[model samples]
Target: MVIELYTYPVGFIFTFFSILSLFRLKISLTIKFGIVGNILYCLSILTSIPMMYYFTRDTPLLLLLLSRISLLIINLIYLHKLRLKKREITLEDESEIRKTILNLGTKFMRLEVREISEKCGFDRDSIIGVLKKMIINEEIYADFFQTTNTVSFDQQTNIDEIDRLMTVYKDWEKDHYEKET
Candidate 1:
């Protein structure tokens, strides 16, 4: 009788902390480790329900229902927050990919797309997609040849474009500076 009295609250507290800890370790589970990380996270959440319910069964019906319902609600809210964080993390990843492509694109006069894909640990299509976006955004000075499956960089052209952009920026700054002040 004495042990049973303490077990419910103790177990509930443990499960609560377990869930909270999982939420705290968001980056390691959801972003860095990928699918396996997600699986472990979901399992921790799913397992917590049964653990809480088992402890609550001998208590009043109201307490049991409240514990289960509250746990589910908390899980839902945390999942929603995790989804938002995942979106932010994904955007950061795309930016990193863009930077990597720019660095690789500059290292050679002409390089194979497959080679960059291998170095970046992403698929060939993903690499091509990032490269296309970079080209569209004028973030890289390169010609992407889909027919030949290669990218060719011209540093001189890039330098000229940079100089032109600087001149345009300076003119814009001069025009806007006086008005804003």
Candidate 2:
């Protein structure tokens, strides 16, 4: 009965993992899912091999082998695509942040996360999450202080200013991470 379901399981599992990997929140789950799914697929094929002798026909055996190989190839392609992908922001997220930043303006150097949340019509935690990513990736001159629950922003619009601040931030992040280990 289990052997009968082999054909559907691998394709479904690979697809599930590949789709799961598209979302950033479940990245670890996707990696584990892919690894486990592929291993299970391989094991299923190995076990299925002995059944080849039970069948009298070459065509069924050939069909089964072809299907297995096809599924493997498809999954390998999906994994490759997943590897090339970076976490992406939707248009709504980008525009929302843009509006939030515009609201923050070029003058204000700092504000509380709750303030930004109320002004931007976004949740406080998500605002912090997006700002943290912006600080790391876009070199946005912002710092999220968890203790005070405040976001400190540098009003300096100059590229050189941002670069220097980002360098300092990277050092701080490195030290922080090092201490955690």
Which candidate number has the best TM-score? 1
Q: What is the C-alpha lDDT profile of model 1 across 44-108, one tens digit per residue?
A: 44455565558865445445456555655665566667655543435666776677676665567
C-alpha lDDT of all candidate models, in order: 0.64, 0.67
Clashing pairs in 2: none
The residue ranges of model 1 lying beyond 4 angstroms of the native Cα positions read: 1-89, 159-181
lDDT of 2: 0.67
Q: What is candidate 2's lDDT per residue for 45-144, written digit by digit as tens?
A: 5566666656753466566666756766775666666544533446796579766764574547888877777777765556666778777875466777
Give per-model CA RMSD.
Answer: 11.3, 15.0
Instruction: Give TM per candidate.
Output: 0.38, 0.36
lDDT of 1 at 181: 94
Given candidate 1, what's the lDDT at residue 64? 48
Native-to-model Cα distance after best TM-score fit, residue 144 in candidate 2, in Å: 1.5
Model 2 CA lDDT for position 181: 100
